[model samples]
Target: MTLLAIPAPAGWDLDLAHDYDDDLPPAGAEAPEQDVVAPDPAGLAAVGLDERTALLDAYVRGELGRVLHVAPGSIDVAGRTMNSLGVGSINGLELQARMEAALGIDVDLQRLLRANSAAELIDCLAGQLGPEDSPHKSAARRSTGTPAAAA
Candidate 1:
């Protein structure tokens, strides 16, 4: 399988798309049963940095859509900033509160203000949940004087 690397903001970059082999099985070939495991919501907090980033991205997109009264899929969250969505300070606070509640994490209001785009916001949240040795967490700790909790 070949993986596709879609360019995204730092920490948000992922290679989820794959190209499967074109070769087909011969006629009448039997296929084996495959077990598919669903993601567990309860285990989200234990997930690694990459998974947390993805979850945060989805959360931001959904919340933005709900608050903006637009379809989640219709919003180009990665490319657009909250300000571009016509969100003011009050709306930004509302969005931040909603995200904190949904993710069960405390995020700094100043960090939210500094984030210029959805991708930037994702990076910020990911840093809080990233590994202990991550530079993102180090930077955040320096700025906030508090280490971020694990996801």
Candidate 2:
């Protein structure tokens, strides 16, 4: 949840269509568009042992969306690569910290870095919470289950 909503500086138009001098696409060429999906608070808040994996997926996408300044639902949580999502080392680190804090578990940053896609990253993080890891289980005590192993 957002703790603060910082307002943009007044009178400063930062949109690409307004203040930027970006090279426009060739005349008659249509710009590729991505569908932006609205945030789903209910989905984000979903809980339970059965829902644990889904919860982690939602959290990962939500954190990714926050980092990229996009809608969480717009993310292909199960497919898109972190590189395509614009998650470089800096933001990837931030995403790691956010997940650690939000999911109440210890995450391996190196493993996180090795993740090719958001789906893999979610699986890596959730897999660390398997029943064998009692310490992690207590940290993520809200529920217990081996989160689905994503492909």
Candidate 3:
């Protein structure tokens, strides 16, 4: 007679598990979810540079209006090579303010000095936009609005 091997139920692999010598605690210790964090400042720097380049191209092409949308797979200032709109220093500040508002970050003229290009600004934004970094946190603290509690 041939011996047949029966398949174990799901999650029955306990080869790596050990039994406790004494009484055990309740089962299922849940782990906390972590927030997403940016890899490094280098990535941010690259984004900043790319933004500046895209702005220059948009200015030259007379398509500065499209400059507002500069995310990846979208309109890129770095991708375009030529334009005619003339992106001056004053325009850069305006662009920065718009970006800050869109991204919900505090990017002022001083912050702009810290970042040389769009990529770098993106990196900084990433850090501030982490899962735990909620712009609405302050509002929640002040009880300005009620949030639906997690189920």
TM-score of each: 0.55, 0.52, 0.31
How high is the lDDT of residue 38 in model 1? 24
lDDT of 3 at 67: 39
Tens digits of per-residue lDDT for model 1, 16-106: 5853444755667754332223233335436787887787777677776666656667877666666776666876787777766555456
Q: Which stretches of candidate 3 lie over 4 Å from their true place?
A: 1-88, 133-151
Per-candidate RMSD, Å: 18.3, 16.5, 19.8
Tens digit of lDDT per residue, candidate 3, span 40-132?
323332354445334423332222343332222343334332122233456656655554444334445555443444444343444443334
A best-first ranking of the candidates according to their lDDT comes to: 1, 2, 3
Q: Lowest lDDT 10-mer window, candidate 2?
A: 36-45
Residue 15 shift from truth in candidate 3, angstroms? 83
Candidate 1's displacement at residue 7, Å, is 53
Q: What value of lDDT does candidate 3 attain over all alpha carbons?
A: 0.39
Model 3 lDDT, residue 72, Cα: 29
Candidate 1 Cα deviation (angstroms), residue 17: 48
Question: In candidate 2, what are the lDDT values of residues 1-151, reduced to their tens digit?
Answer: 7699667799976565663335866678764533334223233334433465676676677777787767788888666677777887888788777665555455556656656788877655554544543333323322444342221
Best by lDDT: 1
